[model samples]
Target: MTTSTKQRPEPMSVRRRTPAWAKAVIALVAVLAVLFAGLRLSVLPGLRDLFGMDTHDRSGPVLLRSIQDMSRYEAASGTFQVVVDLERDSKYLPSAIRGTRTLYVGAGTVDAYVDLGRVGRQDVTVDADRTSATLRLPHAALGKPTLDPDRSYAVSKQRGLLDRIGDLFSDNPNSERAVQKLAVRHIGEAAKESELTARAETNTTAMLDGLLKSLGFKEVKVSYGT
Candidate 1:
């Protein structure tokens, strides 16, 4: 009887290195993640966005700042007409959601003009040196509690009245409308970026509050379309 000596199986040697394809995939994934991180954290914050910094919340302070900045440019002798159109977004229907304004600032940046739907339209002209400012408004679109230079520069009712007054004089408020286009074409340029867009839309709302203190407007009437 030949006793069969059981030969112990040689210990198996296993290689621990990761698969080549898996290594390549891991490297690629790592590179992409680094690039994405750089963009999200470093590259985007200071990129001079026309619409101001990105806001997670749409209805935030960016709109107000844009308007204020435009006004500052006006007060500084920059001739430009900023058109704040409350144009309806065709996609967003059934509700009047105030969309971006198209700012049409003129050359020299001295004059600025914009249309604020409920507040009415305005045309502002400031001297090159920022000394004097002239605003033209149609007498028809005036709203209540308007500034009354005719009444008194120290207007009792001009409290919180700066939003709609920039348009001075009895001139053609929307003259650009008749000759085949709005006045924007003749001005500096249309604000194509989101930054100026916000300003154009909200300029009326911000300026009106401040103008009340300066007696900047002569009259303001609501519900009038002119």
Candidate 2:
């Protein structure tokens, strides 16, 4: 009866449980590491805040902006121009096909109204002859402000009101460098980058197609204005 009774303990070996495909491969590696950390922390800053100020880049699909003539306005009296033409299509997104003071064309007024007893107004200006491509007007100050119905004075002593407020702020830096250069040139022409451009150079198919060819109505055909 000595050690023979201890053999009963060998029948107690029952340790089995823990494999449902190894707990489904550890829950599929913790759901692919929580989907790659939610695509590196919330989908890359929501796409850089709807894409803007990424500095832009297209390398060379064409981007040129080299106009000049800005020296304290070179003697400002209204005739400071630096224009060009050629834009099959543009609506702003990241522009620079050209800049540095653009107004391709504007500030054109040829109004002539007079009658001393009341109504009075005179103006005729169209400037921009960047070395000669034609476009400079004033016709000798429109013939020295014609309206001589027995002149006595009141044309603000020959165009005054501080010279019409310095000719209406002298084209305010050429219409604010042509709207900050057409809003930095089409900011990518769309698809993103904060989209908001395409004023298409003051609508009407480019300002009434260069103002109906400077009113000569050069084969008119521009109706866009939305």
Candidate 3:
């Protein structure tokens, strides 16, 4: 008994300490929350400005190129998109050391046209009464691929250590000329393989037929030259 024996030892006061990682996570979350609030409130200059995102266009004034009269009728046009992947690799080095790769998304339009200026007196045949007419027209031709700057862009690019270092001294380091040329070539090839010309011929024929009928021709026969 001895004075109710030694007082029961007070339960050791246990204080759990938060792990370092957990504390760090909490701090990061708090910072992010504050940033989000600032962004939402428009009190920040935005992430882009904060990260020094900027662009300066020092392009020269556009010169007026020579103008030429055009007499071609664009009968059909086709919109096209292509992905160009171009790469260059060093013969004795790995990609990470001396290689470069680019991915570009190109958008353009190809026009199918009939050159009305090419048609002459010999190309048209008319009956004595002028009630019937026949037109021999040149085959539809494809126009140059016109790339859309607004819709065409470079998706991604990767360069090796040496290549990146070299770019620092290059005049046009981020040039997309190669990929743009490839894209144009691919688009031209695709247009050639498509039925765009055939469609153009059909449309031109319809247009001619309607016009001839309105002009008092009872019969209109349209044919294409080789």
Candidate 4:
């Protein structure tokens, strides 16, 4: 029988099946990756827009704007701090229902401007020799004061037991708005007393005087309307 006894092939080891949990984990990982990719793509446009990345330098004006803003005076008022006491009581038993007191502080700014666009043909007169010029302008007026909502805040709030109990059920939404209004009123009054109009007038005169001199006029005169 000689040397060659047929050698039987070693039995092939059976491949182990993957565990259910392991397969599930792999599937979950794949699903999460896909979802994450989709979410990133979804917010890409918003991110780009927020950062102004979608804009280009191709500039064009579709229409010529006639009106212009010549902001001559920027009058900022001093901070106004006040405490407001608010009371809302039952019509019959006024003392039984107590109220709240709030301390509010606010600041604002007012602007004064001259609109050159409003000047009429007759408003400007150039002397025959072109050595003198006169310009008539409108009177300086106060702009609406804008309350800085960010800087304005409620310093403190004092609420009675009754008020607290009532607040649990309903909230007073108008309190903050009321505070802002009060601050704006005080700022407006303060700005009116700041002589901003006179400052604006002086600035306007100086500005025109320089402009006329630059244009070779020996004498320049500026007048304001009532």
Best by lDDT: 3
User: What is the alpha-carbon lDDT of model 2 when measured against the actual structure?
Assistant: 0.32
Best of the candidates, TM-score: 3
Q: Supply the TM-score for candidate 4.
A: 0.58
Candidates ranked by TM-score: 3, 4, 1, 2
Q: Please give, for residues 37-61, the per-residue lDDT of candidate 2 as tens digits.
A: 4444336777656664557666866
lDDT of each: 0.37, 0.32, 0.91, 0.71
* Clash count, candidate 3: 0
| Residue-level lDDT tens digits of model 3 in 130-194 | 99999999999999998999999999999887787687689998899999999999999999999
Model 4, residue 63: displacement in angstroms? 19
**Regions of candidate 3 where Cα sits further than 4 Å from its true position:** 1-65
lDDT of 1 by residue, 1-226 (tens): 6898999999999979999999999998787556434344335565445445655756745454343322122211222333333232335432222222233322213223343322323555555655455555322211111111222121111111111122224275333232213333433233332244334324544565356426654443222134
Instruction: Tell me each candidate's TM-score.
Output: 0.20, 0.17, 0.73, 0.58
Model 1 poorest 10 in a row by lDDT:
154-163
lDDT score for candidate 3 against the true structure: 0.91
Candidate 4 residue lDDT tens string, 25-86: 99987875574344543466676556554556788867976987564443222334434444
| Cα TM-score of candidate 3 | 0.73
